[model samples]
Target: MNQRTFRTAAATGCALLVAAVGPACTGTAHAASPVGLATARVADAVRFPWLVGPVVVAHRGASRAAPENTLAAVDAAERQGFKWVENDVQQTRDGKLVVVHDGTLTRTTNVKRVFPQRAPWRVRDFTAAEIARLDAGSWFGKGFARERVPTLREFLRRMDEHDLRLLLEIKNPQLYPGIEARIVKELSAAGWLDRQHVRRRLVVQSFGANSVRTVHGLVPEVRTGFLGNPPLNALPSYARYVDQINPQLSKVDARYVAAVHRLRGAHGHRLDVFAWDVPLQNHLGIASTYGFDGVIV
Candidate 1:
C-alpha cells in the first residue's frame, strides 16, 4: 500500500481499538519471558490526540526520502502522515535560528565551495543570509538543488500549516548560550505559546539539562524533554523539570522504562520515556518490547 493509504488504515484501526478498549490499554502489556523477566506487549503509549499509537516520530522530517532538515523533507514527512517530526536548531553568526543537524555545514550543504576561505565552515561562523545562499538539499540529490536551510520561524509555519507536532532540539547549546530563552521568545512571537493546541503540539528538547530547565522556566506550559539517559538515581532530579526522558535506544531497557514511568513530578505528572535514533523498521518492535513510550525514527 502507498504511504497515505497505509496511514489512513492505521488511523482507522487505532480509532477502533481506542473505542473498543481505552487510552490506558494503549500502553504495552508485559508477559513473563524465558529469561525469567517480563517482556512488554506491543501497544501504544503516546496519549496525545494527534498521536494515535506507539509514536513514530519522523527523524529530521522523513530524511530517508528527502534531504535531512530541509523544507522538502518536512513536506515528505507530512505526505507520509507523520504527525510528529524532529529537527535540530542552531543559531547562525547573525543569531538567526536555522534548522540543521550538524555544527558544521560541510556534510549537508555546499559551504566549502561557496566560502573557500572558511575551512572549518562552522554554522556559527556564517550569517543566515550566507547560509541561505548555499544549497542544502543538492548534496543529497540533484532534484532538490533549490532546497535551502529553513529558519525556525519558517519551519514552524510549515508545521502549523500541516497541523504537525514538533520535537525541536537545541543543538550545540554551549555554542549558543541563552538559546532556550530565544526559542521561547520566537515561539511566543509566532503566537504558538498562546494557542492551546499549538503548545500541545510542540516539545522542546536538548542534550543539555540546563537548557531543558531553561525552557521549562521560560514556558512552563510547553513540554520539555531531556535527550540523554542519566543514571537511574538522577531520574528524580530530571523529573523536577523535564516532562519527557529521551534516551538513546541502547541505553534503555524494560526496567529503565518502568523506572521512568514511576517517577512523579510537580503537579502529579508521570514522566514519559522516549527512545531516539531508531533507524530501522525492525527495531520499532524492539523499542515497543522494551516499553518505550515513543520512538524517534
Candidate 2:
C-alpha cells in the first residue's frame, strides 16, 4: 500500500504491519507440503504461540522499505523483525517459480524498457532468463538498482535463512496450468515439506478453490487457506480441505467471523479467519478487536 511503518496497536496487544498498507500477521499453531518431495534436510521454521493477537506478516516484504516481491523486500521484512511474510508466486515459461505479484511485467520491472517490443509482457510469455535480465527494483527506488525478480527458490532461501513463516499465495493460478503441482514440487525440492516446516510455519493459499483443493490433495499435511468467503452453508465442505478462510476486510464482520471459528479444519484445529485489505480510520484496529486470528493490511 504505502511505505510500511511498524507501530504497536498497544490497546489490542498487536503489531501493525500491512500486506498492502501495513500488517497484523498470522501466528504459528504448530510444525510441518507433498509433491515430488524427496526426503531432505528441511529448513527449520521458527515457532510462535498459537492464537496470538494479529501477528505482523510483512506484506510483500515490507513494501514500504523495499520493492515488493524482490529479495530486497524479503530482507527488509526480516531486518524489520517481521516473523512472517506474504508473497505471490507463479511460473516462467521454462517452469521455474518466480516471486512477483502482477500478471504483466510492466508494473514492477523495467520490462517495457528492456524489451520494447514485448508489449504487455505477460509473465507466461517469457523464459526465466528473459525475465531475469530486467531490473525489478529501480521502479521502487534507485537504491535497489539491479535487483532481479527472485525465483521462488531465491525467495524461499531468504525465508529459510531467517526462519520466517510463509503465507505463500498462488497468484492467478488459472493463468498457469498445473501451477499448484509445480509449486508443491518446488517446495518439496527445497525441503519445505519436512515435519518442522509443515507442522509450524507454512500455509498455502489462493482465491481459486480448485487450486486450493489441488494443493490439499497433493499434501494434506500442509495447512491451507481459501481466500474468498463461500456461503456459510459451504464451510463444512471447505473445512475438509482448508484450515483457514481469508476474506478481504470488507466481507469480514463479527457474525461471519464467529461462524468460521465455530468449525474445525481438516487437521482438526479450529478454523481460523484472517482478514485482508483492512480499512482506515482506526478500522484496522477495530478489525483486530473482531476476534480475527490475523489481519492483513
CA lDDT of each candidate?
A: 0.76, 0.74
Model 1 TM? 0.81
What's the lDDT for residue 241 in model 1?
88
lDDT of 2 by residue, 175-222 (tens): 899999999989998889999989878999999999999999999999
Where model 1 places Cα greater than 4 Å from the true spot, the runs are 1-52
Candidate 1 residue-wise lDDT, 90-157, digit = tens: 99999899999999999889999999999799999999999999999776656678999999999989
Count clashing residue pairs in model 1: 0
TM-score of 2: 0.82
Quality of model 2 by C-alpha lDDT: 0.74
TM-score against native, each model:
0.81, 0.82
